[model samples]
Target: MKLAQRTALVTGAGSGIGRAIALCFAREGAAVAVNDIRRDRAEAVAQEIRALGRETLTLPADVSDSVEVRAIFEQLTAQWQRLDILVNNAGIVELEPSRQQRLIQAHMERLAGSGAPAPLAISQSITDMEWRRTLAVHLDGTFYCTREALKLMEAQRYGKIINMASVAGLTGLAGAAAYSAAKAGIIGLTKAIAREAIHCGVYVNAIAPGFIDTPMLAEMDAEMKRLIALQAPIGRFGTPEEVAAVALHLASDDSSYTVGQVLSPNGGFYM
Candidate 1:
């Protein structure tokens, strides 16, 4: 009940890390608003929160769309009157499956010293659409939601904003140029907002988790996944629940003195 009486909104709450964070907050006594671009998924998570005996709201909107984002805040404000926590966790890996598979295969071959001498050309392979969509969802979505959440939190002089970044943002992934760029942008955004939001008693921070056992990585073939897991000293992928624990800390008073920091749960992958 560390979060008793607090209200939280978790974007992308339908699945993976976002879903874990929403449920974690609910278990700790926060009334949670679940947001997912997929309305059905949003409703599903909201139902779970209701079962937890905590208040719940379902927000179905594309965070990349400013208009949709604004409407989401309006509905939240109308229903809850105030918000204490916001998790900017909506994101996507927009690379085509075929392209992603090829890239992964190429990387493996390269590691074995058997691939083509040329680079993967991943940056050159990115279409304008892929680059824009990646940034729109990861970077722009964070900005729009943060702006709206600030409106309510600023008035109350207290809030917690947890932005989801990635290990790719810190040590760029070889073939995920767009995702790496977008996450790096989010890290920059978190830092900038933290400096400003702290003035109003709002704590802003980021969680850059390592490869987690989520649907995102479920797309990878078993061999690729195995190799990635071994990249971490822990010799395994992280769990969404594990990442949610960090989110819980940031959203509660436990992190009162923590601000503008990127707390990574990468199992020594980067450090």
Candidate 2:
């Protein structure tokens, strides 16, 4: 009951790491608000939270939309009137088939001892819409949600904000320039806001997880998945529950002294 009587809002709680975190908080005695672009998915997670005997609020909204985000906070205030935790976990990844095919071919060439460098023109291949959408979802969505959460948190003089980053942000990943940039921006935003919000008793931190076995990875072919798992020193992809454990720590009083820090759950992937 580390979070007894507390309240939390987790974006992207429909599935994967976000859903795990929502359930973890609920188990710890927090009334959870589940948010996802898909209403059915949000409701599904909300149903799980209710089964745990915790109050649940299902919020279906695209975080990238400022209007929608504001409406979400308004609903939160009307329902609970307080927000103790905010997890900005909603994100999306876009990789064109042509780009991925090119990357795969280059990888195969290198494996065949071609000696020639792989021309990963990921940046050049990114469509304007893809670039903007990636940032809009990860970076802009985080900001929109955080801005609304801060109003509630700062007023209460107590809050925990956790931003989900990635190892790709720390050690840039090939073929994912937009995603890397978005995550890197989140890290920067987390630090800057952590410094500003700490004075108001609102602690902000980030979690940069490595390859986690989430739906996000479902797009990768089996071979690509195997290769990625081996990339981690742990020799396997991390689980959603593993990342949720870290989120729980940051959400609770255990991380009282930790602020403006990027707590990476990367299993020896990027040092």
Candidate 3:
């Protein structure tokens, strides 16, 4: 009941880490706003929260869409007039092949004779579009939601913002150029905001998770899993509940003095 009587908004709460955090908040007596792009998934989480006798609101919207983000915030404001916590956890990843540069060069040559848009490929490094889109969802979404939440928090002089980053933010991960950059941006942004919000009684922080047993991990092949497990000193993937534990601490008064810090839940991966 650490979050009793609090109001929290958790983006991407339909599944994985986001869903786990939303449920944890609800179980601890917080009224939660569960948001996700998928209406069915969001509703399902909300229903589960309600079943636990906790207050819940299911808001379906794409975090990248400013219009939808505004509408969702407005609805929350109308209902509670204030927010105690905001968690930005929605993200996407694109794995470009290592030989992308050579492939792009070949494609460009083949398209030279055709009067069509160049058959561009994401460079061996990564494509601008991929980077932009990744940043839009992870960094931009965090910015938009935090911006809106701050308005309410500033007035009350109280709030907590827990951004979801990744170990990729701290260290480069092969083939995850866009995701790595976007998450790194989140960590930097969290620190800046935390410094600014200190005087106003608001704390901003981020959690950098390592390999977790989420839906995303489920999608990985056995070899990928083996490689990831080997990377973690613990030799196994972490769980959503483990990450949720740190999130709960940051969202509550227990972490009042902790600001502008990126707490890593990784199992000795970056240490």
Candidate 4:
């Protein structure tokens, strides 16, 4: 019960990594606030915690929407008054390797042949909706949620913020440009926040997981799955529980001395 009597808000807690983190924290005795864009999913997770004899609050809101993110915090304040931990873990990944490669190659060719301004023509092959949507869900959501969390944390002079980055961010995954870019932004945000809040006892950090056996990896074919597992020197993909363990450490007082660190549990994939 490392988190006994603590209060935490985990976004996207309806499924996958977020769900695992929520359950793990609840087992460790944290009164968790389970958040998901879906009301039903949020309620389900909240119920699971209650069954464990832990207090819980279900927050159903799209974190990508700034308005909803603010309201979620307001609701949390009414229940707990203060927050001890926050895990910004909501994200989406689209598996379109060929499409991603096409965009990247086209972008590179244009940059080389036309001396084009990089920012003006970034990934023309990718649609505006796809790019914006991915960033909105991951990067924008993190910023909005963190902005709100910082208010409560800075005032109290103690808080833990754990962001969900991916190995794609550390070493761009060929088929996941948008996801990789968004996660990379999260890593940068964590470092900046850690530095800014260093004197306030608000520790910010990120976890970069590699090929975890979660819903994100469910759609891959057997061959693709095999390749993914073998990509890691450990000869297997990781588990959500394994990733949750790292969250426990970062969200606890044990990480008081750590700041803006991006912890990678990649099974020796990237070194």
Candidate 5:
């Protein structure tokens, strides 16, 4: 087991990419801390880790909330004593009900097969409230978790951080300006931290995925998805398991010489 005896924390572990990463880490012999917005979902992932005979702790918290993020670290310290790997995977693309009800309603109507596609004009039509909410979760949340994890990693003089970005960050995806901006920031942040912390044996890296077959993409129109898949030079969408393999590589000693790099498993969709 590459990660035997190490400790890992995977945010948004209730499902999708996060769940896959959490399970992959556990199988590689890492004690995993699973965080999700839903308590039930967190517990479910935690149970899967336990089934592998690996230690696990599950707590539901909003990664965008500094208070909650700090509490998660405190609890992790109490349980695992140290964090060897941190996967900043918690993120959301949906707008809050209170802030963008009309936009969401129109979008949902389209998804329900009622009308023309309601594509939000990312650069001009987005509201201030919607922009803030998306950035709060994707960008601010990553900063909060990383800031807290940094202190712990610095003290130990060893660490591995895997920040999740997307192809949107490299080549902005239409209709997702906020998400694109946030992910781009993550790549910049990863490089900045690596330069500062590398001498101390703390490595920071990022992963940029494209057209992954995950639940989040389920909302896309069938034709849209098919067209996107065709754009992949590989002729197919990637799987969570495939991404998890890359995460496992970065989290282990195998990646000791690699730092501040954004690894993309986009099937040649982006290079």
Candidate 6:
């Protein structure tokens, strides 16, 4: 019951890491807000939380949209009057290099045929749209939620914000330029907010996960899976529960003195 009587909002709670965090928070005695773009999935998580005798709110919205974000917060504010914790864990990944390239090329070709002048060829390094969307969902979404949540947190002079980053943010991957750049931005933003919030009794921190056996990792090929397993010092991918445990620690009083730190549950991949 580390989070007893607290209220928490978690984005991307439909499945994977986000769902795990939502469930963990609820089990620890928090009134959980489970948000996801898919209505059914979000409600499913909410239903499970209720079955556990925890108060829950199911909010379905795209975090990238400002209007929906504002509405979600308004509902939360009206219900709880205060938000104790905010976990920005919603994310998407693009893993297939060849298919990604082809998709980008086809999109450009379509736009060109539609009479919109075609831009330059898509760069193998990173396409403009990919960079934009990555930043929008990861970096921009974090900023939007943190900014909105801080207003309420500041009033109470007590709050915790846990952002989900990744090892790719710390170490670049060949085909993950956009994702890596966005996550790197999150690390920088987390530090900046932590400094400002410390004076007001708020803590802002991030978690950089590596090769978690979530749905995202399941999309990888056998070769990629073998490579990741071989690379990890523990010789296995981490589980969503393992990463969620660290998030729970950060969100609770146990991490009262910890701020602006990126906790990596990466199984010694980088170290």
- lDDT, candidate 3, 1-271, per-residue tens: 8999999999999999999999999998999999998999999999999998998888898898888999999999998888999999987766343334434445456658545544444435566777789989999999999898999898899999999999999996755767888899999999999999878999999999998888865546555567668878898889999999999999989997898999999988888
TM value for model 6: 0.90
What stretches of model 3 exceed 4 Å from their correct place? 95-125
lDDT for each residue of candidate 5 in 39-102, tens digit (9 for 90 to 100): 9999999999999999999978999999999999999998878899999998877433332444
lDDT of each: 0.93, 0.93, 0.87, 0.89, 0.87, 0.88
- The CA lDDT at 82 in model 6 is 95
Q: Which tens-of-lDDT digit does each residue in 29-55 have in candidate 4?
A: 999999999899899989999998999
CA error at residue 201 for candidate 1, angstroms: 0.3
Q: Which stretches of candidate 4 lie over 4 Å from their true place?
A: 97-124
Error of 1 at 85 (Å): 0.1
Judge candidate 2 at residue 38 and give its lDDT.
96
Which residue pairs show collisions in model 2?
A: none
- Per-residue CA lDDT of model 2 for 144-250, tens digit only, reads 99999999999999999999999988898888999999999999999999999999999999999999989987777676667677778888889999999999999
Across residues 1-271, which tens digit of lDDT does each residue of candidate 6 receive? Answer: 8999999999999999999999999999999999898899899999999998999999998898888999999999998899999999988887765644544555557857866544433346566777788889999899989999999998899999999999989997546778888899999999999999989999999999988998876667665677668788999999999999999999999998898999999999986
List residue ranges in candidate 1 displaced over 4 A.
95-116
Task: Itemize residue pairs with steric clashes in candidate 1.
Answer: none
lDDT of 1 by residue, 1-271 (tens): 8999999999999999999999999999999999999999999999999999999999999999999999999999999999999999998985456666776778767779984655555678889988999999999999999999999999999999999999999999877889999999999999999999999999999999999998877667776678788889999999999999999999999998999999999999998
lDDT: which is higher, 1 or 3? 1
Report how far off residue 222 is in candidate 6 (Å).
1.5
| lDDT (C-alpha) at residue 187 in model 1 | 96
TM-score to native of every candidate shown? 0.96, 0.97, 0.89, 0.90, 0.89, 0.90
Global CA lDDT of candidate 6, please?
0.88
